[model samples]
Target chain A: MTTTVIEESFRPGELEVRPDGTGNLLGSRCRSCGAHFFPTREACAGCLSQDLDAVKFSTEGVLYTYSVVRQSTPAFEVPYAIGYVDFPEGVRIMGQIAGLEFDEITIGMPMTLSLEPFGENEEGDPLTGYRFRPAEVTND
Target chain B: MTDVHVVGVGMTRFGKHPDKDATDLGAAALLEAVADAGIDPRIIESAYVGHVFQGMVTGQRILAQVGLAGLPLSNVENACSSGATAIREASLAIRAGENDVVVAVGTEHLTSKFSGALTPDPSDPEAAVGATMPGVYAMRATRYMEDHGMTREQLALIPVKNKANAARNPLAHFRKEITVADVLESRPIADPLNLHDCSPVTDGAAAVIVMSDRAAKKYANGRGVRLAASALRSGSVDVTPTSMTFEPLTWATAQDAYERAGIGPDEVDFAEVHDCFSIAEVLRVEGLGLFEQGSYPWAVERGEADINGRLPINPSGGLIGKGHPLGGTGVAQVVELVRQLRGEAGDRQIEGAKVGLAHCRGGKAVGIEGAACTVQILIR
Candidate 1:
């Protein structure tokens, strides 16, 4: 595990983040059928169209549903709030809600995607992770 | 469409086998199946191989080891249902007149992928932070308990019963029977799901030989189990996204299978359902309409699903006892049903079994249930 900032333009297998530091999610737009995906793909899963355009998504969304996880596993942190957020673009993303008590998180809470620094790996490497933060965060 | 019959089924003992690779175990099962069917390898017209986590061209890798030559080979991966999906495809190909005889094989070497690390989804930022499979099922267990007043002891009974059944199965991964107290005493993987409630990471393979009705009558010994229906359905994304609730996909698939076979759930003598987690067995039993909602645990407690019960469930011990090798589980379930329908399960066999159902549900993707839910009905 190595820690380095990703500055070059790149296409993730599922998602794309713009270089403007705006934390907007990126997806592929099917030029033929206008189908959108959260994690952009090279081909349109709907129309099988190869002609696609990379598009940035709105950073803001509303919580669709959530679960306050009281248990932990190798896959996720324990005692965290995880849920799906519905963006205006008709795409839903599964993510973690930050800066809220497990009991405080509710359905339809306004949230915005944010880039936060995750902790080190086993070899002590820094990692940056993303989460859904309350819309009214003072720092942002 | 032409009918297809499963003439022979074979499965390697399910457990941690550090000595064998995926192909090695796959070929072992294939050999056993071929011998069981008393057919030469050359009789197989094509092969459908199912695997997950194995790299690209897994079918080619496995079949090549068995000296298979140029034939239509397709690799399938549908998460947990990969095995049954492969069987369905192979059966369809034979029915379509593309082949006279087809081999369906599924193998998993999970020991290679058991590294204790977060498998973050590259596409979902939330997945990057952490969301494990156990956590998702735990959420479901929590919700089910809260909604149905189900107890942890009730959930624990699933493994207790399955392990007891596994004790009778030589192919089971864990042959030791456990009590509900033992299940509750085990280490917690997630809230309400102790280590005993979860299926072990296993390495195994299961194969079945499916032949067209014409070929079966000509070559098979008239001992083949008929495949009445094989249906796959996916969950509806439009519904409220909740892991704990029963999804429509399972119901749709079960109904499709039942209708295709012209039989109802009441006609099913026994079933082998996906019990990746103990709570999942509860959901599947309810979702399949075998028992009323919120009555699965009660049914188990009353031995309604026992091997001697009116409607036995998981007579082969399910994923909990038989072990979920992911890709091999679905096919293994079919193998068990075939054995029961043939009256060959011995002590574990359901008495006078005629119609058997095998239901498998895979993991979730994008907040929905598995990408595929498959149900297959077999009749003697």
Candidate 2:
């Protein structure tokens, strides 16, 4: 089986690519107001502070809400699950749910970010993007 | 500021219009409004037109079709609130003493332009990630059910009620009452939102003639609904993640309208709100303070939101039953308000109705609660 060599990120700013095949969602943290945002921001929405720093968000989050999308535009396939996961940074990010059955998904479930094959580039190279999966519970 | 009144309102039958274009529909609605006002078409000194998907000079095309090509005109676009924004701009013009009589028209030939689920702008990150309008609302419906204990059966009643109201509205797209079973059995567009739960892609137009007190006195012929307030607001960027079950954008816009009208939610006799989806009606009415927070689904089940209920909601059948032509949706809401307030609604008339409200919230952008929202209150 052939493997991907040259990989790229669909959204370079929102989704960071790592040489090690693992990356985190990027967001902005306001230095003055202590607020965080998704997809990053130039200024703090709360205090309008311009002192912002781009940071990687935690991979784990809680599923706040979700839906099974049956119809969509031509870009994406149909019958995929989508939801918003609330990260510790106080930002809720929406993405397609992966690695979970439709019936197995529920609100308030613990989810961990997982990078997987997403789409192609202008040169038709496969790219890695992020999705959420159920965090494995440990038997303590 | 001078008191503004909707001297007349008109709307074309909302459904598939293969023969008519946006300009044709707009001119038809405009001429109807002018005739309804019992005034010469030349009395309209200025105009505002709202549309989306239709290209530039859409307003100019409508003016040319209506034979008022030389009049000063402006075209407005604010997502689904485009038409309502046009009305708000016209009201502001009178309040600013810019014009005594102005016409606002909203028209869209949506069936020709789009058929499937609408999306945010292509540049939006959400669009790139496969977000459909139905999918977003379905997620909200799921969250609302999870947060408020709203059952699936109860949510089905919203479409049922709206379609029943549509049966009486001659100009509505749907005239047959549907059942909760119909909603459950319909093809699923998104989980928790079936075909019936979503508004249709329609092609239609609606127009309203707003006049200052002086023009109203001459053209009203004892039929004028006071445009008490026309308030608009854009969605605030979310500094922190907020509840999907509530609409801060809708509340803020309605608050501006309430303060300007010097009235509270309790005084509103009836309302026509944007019900693009079944869940949207719940969010809008509750957000507008027509009902308590997290309580609209149960309210729909209790017959409290019926045509003859304690507080009538969507007496014109809303976007669901009446059909949603995007740009036309907002103006049609005002047309319904004017008809109900004037006791001109033939079969679905809300008798003795004096105060009516129209709410429109449209467009969805990433990181915001909503895109643009407008609230207009009318008193007769």
Q: Can you list each candidate's DockQ?
A: 0.17, 0.79
- In the range B1-380, model 2's lDDT, one tens digit per residue, is 79999998889999999998999998999999999998899889999999997889899999998789999899999999999999999999999999999999999999999978998897776776778899999999999998999998999999999999999999889999999999999999989999999999999999999999988888898899999999999998888899999999999999999999999999998999999999999999999999999888888888999988989999888999999988899999999999998888999998788999999999988888899999999998
Q: What C-alpha lDDT do the candidate models reach, one value each? A: 0.80, 0.91
Candidate 2 displacement at residue A69 in angstroms: 0.3
Candidate topping lDDT: 2
Segments of candidate 2 deviating more than 4 angstroms: A1-6, A137-140
Query: Candidate 1's residue-wise lDDT over A64-112, tens digit each?
Result: 6665654445445566777677887767776677878766665668988
Instruction: Give the residue spans of candidate 1 off by over 4 A.
Output: A1-93, A97-116, A119-140, B116-126, B239-243
CAPRI class of candidate 2: medium
Quick one: best DockQ, which candidate?
A: 2
DockQ of candidate 2? 0.79
